[model samples]
Target: MKGNTLQPMTMPFRVGNVAPDPEREHAAPVRIPIGPEATLLKEPLLGRYASTRRDIDLDMDAMRAARSRGELPPFGGPWFGGMEKDVAWVNTTRVIGDASDAEELTRAEVTGRKDSVVMLDALREHSPAFKDGRLLHTSTQIGVRETRCLLGAYTLTGDDIRTQARFDDGIAVGCWPIDVRPAGDVGVHAMYVPLPYEIPYRSLLPRKTDNLLVAGRCISVDREALGSARVGATCAATGRAAGVAAALAATGGKQPRQLDAGQLRTAVRAQGGRVTPPAH
Candidate 1:
């Protein structure tokens, strides 16, 4: 499948302007209530604990009403809420269009900027916290979700995740569920996975390129499986595995595929990674 491109967004707080060594603790559990009309296409906001009342809800009723009246273009979804000290971040605009096409991408970027302005206006009008807030910055670059996936030694599939298949060369674990967005009339289809599943080392090894090792979201995986494995934490784990395997291969004067899976697992474990499956 073709890889996805990023959706550009703006932030409330400016970077670098904030004091160094900012508060290191979450004061309380931040839970933003989503309106019934909000079509959350992804998972809920998650973070560590703090006892302070920093929570804020993203009421999409205004946006939904505007959509119904054809006042705004349907481009992107909102990020419920997030905060870093005095600065809060929310993504309520998305430039819904083809990301691959040059002309469309340009248009999407423009639309994204405009949407951010509108979203900020709405936030300032409705949310008390954002009443005095100013736009700190807009992302310099657009983020791409999917692009090109390498055809590796082994490609992960939805069935592998569903069955919780174990691989002798498993190097990383993924726990996120399949979160595919809706297309046309089809609604968002999300499948929850209770258990963490293995991501095999072979998935990082490109089939034809002996020297190349793939990691992160670009690693070999079917579209359905990609949804679970593409998250930040899972990608980080896979990246660590790839780094370790690459170093071992380089030292041994061997290709990534030539490195023994057992040795790799041993090295990964030494570095505080859990390569073995938990006792069933």
Candidate 2:
């Protein structure tokens, strides 16, 4: 595989599960009350957020609409599934910095928190439902999307996802599209994948690391490929595969790279994971 030439991307944001105040009277009757559960997708107010340094992009109208949800998970699912809530505080403020820079990341944390408050203020101004609303809980730390990645024994690329590439050592499967939030862009740039693709165990094996195995978004993948591989479900699948491999390596007294691929695939399949493309 060729050396990684893509720069790591970063998106710093916060989430607050909000609830409406019972004592407050609504200027406009709550049209669509925040529900028990909802789906998530990209919002339309990102352009406004991108231009204003201290502003956030949230779909205020959708909060009242039943369809309003955020895409924090793969397959366009909601992260806060079973939470019994009325409102979701979706903060769209962003911070960009080098992943290796501690000062920048620290700034992201501080800035992200401050911006989240700014978003809350905007929400209050946008709707009266939250005029007296209270925050149930807020994210303690800023969420960072990408950082330094490992160039492992095998590299998963965007082409692999599009063509549904399968490997003999396949350990996990991902079907999320190539969703990238470019720095200073209005919204995410997405390239939908045709089908689910396999993640090889070789991608988890670092070239120089003897016994160490990498998983999740940090596994060997190019920049374009990371866009699709960097979601919660995909990350979890890769993590489980890595854990299984790690356990097998420890028990067998062998390096992770030296483990049998077939054995690992069988073990993962036994655990109810999809290491190959699903039949259409």
Q: TM-score: which candidate is best? A: 1
The candidate 1 region of ten consecutive residues with least summed lDDT is: 12-21
Clashes of 1: 17
Tell me how far the alpha carbon of residue 202 in candidate 1 is from the true structure, in angstroms, after superposition.
1.1
Candidate 1 lDDT over residue span 147-223, tens digit each:
56889889999888877889999998887666544332111233444356899999999888888898998999988
TM-score of each: 0.74, 0.70
Model 1 residue runs over 4 Å out of place are 1-27, 30-54, 75-77, 97-108, 126-128, 183-191, 277-280
Q: What is the clash count of model 2?
A: 3
- The lDDT of model 1 is 0.64
